[model samples]
Target: MPGSLHNWYSLSWLDMLAERQSVLSGRIELKRLARLRDMLHAHDGSVTVNLRFGKRDGAWVIVNLECEATLALLCQRCLEPMLHTVAARVELGLVESASMASRLPEDYEPVVLEGDRLMPARLIEDELIVSLPLMPKHAHTSECGSLVRRRDESTGEAWTLDCAPPTSH
Candidate 1:
């Protein structure tokens, strides 16, 4: 199927999809993805996934995965629940062994297939994990519920949002 959309479970069907050059698009509930759920403040949404499968360099199998999701993450600064958006795209080269993975070019991320029954959700989750910010925070200090640094442009002084004022000598 040139342009078929289906819910996929395992990479066992990967060869058939590669042969047809299929583009699979679907939504998976965030709560259902175990690894991802553990990293979120609240897994109450879904991720939109699009995977394009085909042959690369005439012989190597490749899958281009794109995932978009809005995750509820705990803001490290304010310790509050904040919405974080992730739009991750990765080009993966499938290989059966570590030796084969070593031969792949730098451009292709090697996905060593342990078995024919690999879950696509795992791959999507991996991308999401890497795309997340190291320290999640609101874009503006006004939106954050924690003490923030404020600069005085005229005096060239800095102060905390909830700190006591300086005492004049």
Candidate 2:
């Protein structure tokens, strides 16, 4: 209880935290989450993480995580940096083994403990990764710097700037 909740804890230790209804709430630097930072163009910001450990339906061991962050990512459409905001909420069912994962309810994502320890930081990072957009881009074409629309009257062909390279006219 005295230590930081982000630190690794034994799977068995979770029960005690759940019993006390422990909550871990803080801001985590993006650089600390290496995998997540690798996916972004700029990792200078921090994410707000709020985790609550408890039992659900009086039988299921669950941890609820809520995360919010603003990340700088390369726009797939224009090849420029764009701000992407992420707000993620995940309900994870804690299980000791992979076999137990299937037992979790549909509403809960199963998090199987590796060996005897659980890494809360890794869990938070994984959740944030999945919450990211598959293809990051500005909402409107006018917002992009390199987006261009070209029309060839002879062939009736129109070209729009995209992730693909432009072909010779």
Supply every candidate's count of residue pairs whose N, Cα or C atoms clash at under 3 angstroms: 0, 0
Error of 2 at 96 (Å): 1.2
RMSD of each: 8.0, 6.9
Candidate 2: lDDT over CA atoms?
0.81
Worst 10 residues of 1 by lDDT: 1-10
Pairs with steric clashes in candidate 1: none
The TM-score, computed over Cα atoms with residue i paired to residue i, of candidate 1 is 0.76
In candidate 2, which residue pairs clash?
A: none
lDDT of 1 by residue, 1-169 (tens): 3212323435647777787898878888898788889999999989999989988777677889999999999888777678999888889988878889888877899988756545677778888888788899898877776333224444456744434676766
Candidate 2 residue 89 Cα shift, in angstroms, is 1.1
lDDT of 2 by residue, 58-103 (tens): 7667899898999899889878789988898888889888887897
